[model samples]
Structures are given as C-alpha cells and as structure tokens.
Target: MTEPIRISRTGSVETWTINRPESGNAITGKDVIAAFEAAAEGANADIAVRAVILTGEGKIFSAGGNVKEMADRQGMFGLDPIEQRWAYVDGIQRIPRALGRLEVPIIAAVNGAAVGAGCDLAMMCDIRIASERASFAESFVALGLIPGDGGSWFLQRAIGYERAAEMTFTGDRIDAPTALAWGLVSRVVPHDELVSTATELAERIAQNPSHSLRMAKRLLLESRTGTLESTLAMAAAMQPLAHADAEHQQRIARWRSS
Candidate 1:
C-alpha cells in the first residue's frame, strides 16, 4: 500500500503529496497526521531543504477530515465529546503546530478540491498557488462542525475577516478565479502546469539566501500578531543575523553584477 504522504526531494525543493486519493486525500487516520508532522520536523532540521510543496494525489487536494469517519464516530470522532476535544489537540491540530515551527517556507500547490480541513491546510502554507481546477471551501459547518484544525485563524489571515467569515458561515466553496480575486492564492495556473509553475516559483525562492528566507518568514508570521513597534524591534534583532550570514556576500556580488 502507498503511504499517507509521498515525499520526494529535488535539490533544494521537496514535494509532499497527501496520498490518500481513495478518500479524496482526507486526513483519514493518525498516520496521515503523524507523517505530515514528521515531514515538517524533518524539513526544519534539514538546512539544505529550503522550500516545500504540498499537494495531493488524484484530482482532489484534500476533503479535510474524513466525513465517513466522522459519521461512523471513528478516529478523532471516536468516543464522546470530551474525547473529541483532546483528539483535535492531539491529532489534526498537530499539523498546524508542527508546520508553524518549520523554518523552511512551504508552497501549497493546491491541485483540486480543498474543503474543510483541507482548505485550512492550504492556508497554513507560506505561499499558495492554485490550479484552475482547484476549489476551496471552509465547509466544516455543513457537517454541523466548525474548523477544528485552526482554519478560523489561518483563513481570516489569508483573505481578511469579512470574506473569511462569509466562507466559514456558509461553508461555501470558491473556485480558483474567485480565490485569486479574494487574495487567497497568489496565482492560478492551468491544471497541467500547476506542479511546474509551483516548482519554478519554489526554486526561484530557494535560490535566495537561506538564512534570510527563514528569518523573513518568521518575521512575517510574527508580524501577524505583533504590534508595529514590536515587529520593528524583532526585525532589528534579526537584521544582524541576516547580514552576518555567508550568503550575504554572494548575494551582494550577484546584485552588483546585475
């Protein structure tokens, strides 16, 4: 059987596919969550891996939590309400937390349907690029549930509060064009070109100074919750490190030549 996530490396970029195409790439079990967490941790430790691409096998990106599992009251939906609460904390929630700590930037090459937790997964990435065939929905409410995997936080940040609220309340799906209009994804590509486009973008990003990329990503995330003064102070602190990095000289040389 295939793994829950198929991981492959090409030079400075690594691609991770949510491989459960049979279930629309839903977070079917602990294996999916664990592997995702492991991948983030591994990427964090590996300095050579500067960027990551997350997509899914088959047509669908991810259906979020498995609705069948939810209906059957299995997996995270196992046992009672109290059990489910801790399950979120211990299970699906781990993905965002692990990813938040990742030093490398992630590009979500959303391939197809991204519903419920699936949508939230894309939101967690540093950058998002969608295929023309891709669709996103904060669809937890349709199941009489809320985004248990932190979609509320990530979604609003991606497209602001009002738009995010509308999507969450109605559990409505928006197509790639609509998503681009709302500033959710940076760009949309032909379905066939999604991977190639994303690879080009990721490689371009990876070619930059590694230390600066990580530092810049951290600053961007922190600034989301930080005040202007604090953000500036943090940036001040990090600037020295970036300047001191060995890549800085090579970058300056390349810049001067250009």
Candidate 2:
C-alpha cells in the first residue's frame, strides 16, 4: 500500500500532506492515525525541525472518517460498541494527544472542504490559514454521529461556545470568509497560494529561536485550561529558561559586541 502521509522538508519547515485523496483523506483508520501519531513524535524529537504545515491532497483537506467503514462496522467502528469504545481510545484520540504534546508550532493550510473530523484536525494545529475555496463544518450530526474525535473541545475553543454550538448543532459548513470572520482561520488566500502562504508563515516562525518557540507554544496551551494566576506562574518558570537558553545567550553576547 502507498504511504498515507507525505512529509517533506523545505528549509526549516516541514509540510505534512494527507496523501489519500482517493479516500478523501479519511483518517480514522489505523494506518492514517498511526501515521499522524508518528509524524507528531518525529517532529517533537527533532529540534532542528522548526515548524510544520498540515494540508491535504486533492479537493478536500480530509473527510474525517471512513463513512463506508462506519456503515459496514469495519475499521474504526468495528466490532461491538464496547470494543469500538476501546478502538476510539486507542485510535483516533491518539492524534489529539500526540498533537497536544508537540513542542513546535503547527499550521494547517486548508485547501478545500474540511468537514467532520477533518475540521477538527485543522483545529489541532496552532494556526490555520484557509484557501478561498476552503470551508469547515462540525458535521457529525448530519451523519447521525457526534464528533467522536474531540471536536467538541477544539471547535468551541477556536470559535467560542455559542458559534461552536451553532455549527455542531447544525452540522453546517462555513466558507473561508465566514471562518475568518468567526476567527476559525487567521487568513484566507486564493487556492493556488495556499501552500506558498502557509510555507511563508511557517518559515517566518522557523526563523525564531526553536526553544523559545516551543516554550511560547507550551504557555499558550497552558493558558487555555489554567487560571490567570496559574498561567502567570507557568510563564514565570519558563521565562528564566528561555532567557538562559544558549540561543538567547548567544544573542546577548552578539548584542554586547555590537
């Protein structure tokens, strides 16, 4: 079988493309899920890999799950409900867990329709840039399912509770402009420019000191669930470490000489 994911490097930035356009980049299968988990781990272990861009092949960023398999009670939705629950715990949920632990920043370049779990995947990234052709939906309800992959948590955080609820309840897709207005994506570009735009953004981020970037990302994650006092305390702890990093020390030395 062909590789489900394609990871390529351009300077300090890596672009991770979902290569299974034939399946609409259905990602709930074991192979795709493991591919994602492995990609996250590889990036986490490599400090030289400064940034990442996530996108998909063909017209859809991803369709989220294998609908045929879901209907057939195969793959991700296989066996009994009890077994399927474990399947979810040991399968698709790993994507978020791995992504949450990623030290470097991630950007999603949404080239087209991002529906169901697909939209949630984009939300997993630290930043999102959508193509003018791009769209998003929390469309589990339309399929008679809920976002079995933690879309509930990520969606609300991206666009707030009310809007997230509206999308979730309606399972309606919002186009790129509306997504931007609602703050789902940072910006929208023409279809042909999505990759270049995302790469430029990733490259800009990669130019920063890697350790500082990781620390800043960590603090942002902490802020989501932490109280202001707790967030401040964490930042205080990380600030010293950032200041003492060799990269920072080198910059200070160079500044002194100049």
Candidate 2 versus the native: TM-score?
0.97
| Candidate 1 global TM-score | 0.96
TM-score (all chains, Cα) for each model: 0.96, 0.97
| Poorest lDDT segment (10 consecutive residues) of candidate 1 | 70-79
Candidate 2 local lDDT, 1-258, one digit each (tens): 888899999888989999999889988878888898899899988889899999999999999988888888776566788988898899889999989989999999999999899999999999999999999999999988899889999999999999999999999989999999999999999999999999999999998899999999999999999999999999999999999899999989999999
Worst 10 residues of 2 by lDDT: 70-79
lDDT of 1 by residue, 1-258 (tens): 788999999999999999999899998479998999889889888888899999999999999888898788776676688987887899899999988998989999999999999999999999999999999999988879888888999999999999999999999999999999999999999999999999999999899878899999999999999999999999999999988888998778888999
The model with the greatest TM-score is 2
Compared with the true structure, all predictions reach lDDT values of: 0.92, 0.92
For residue 11, what is the lDDT in candidate 1?
A: 93
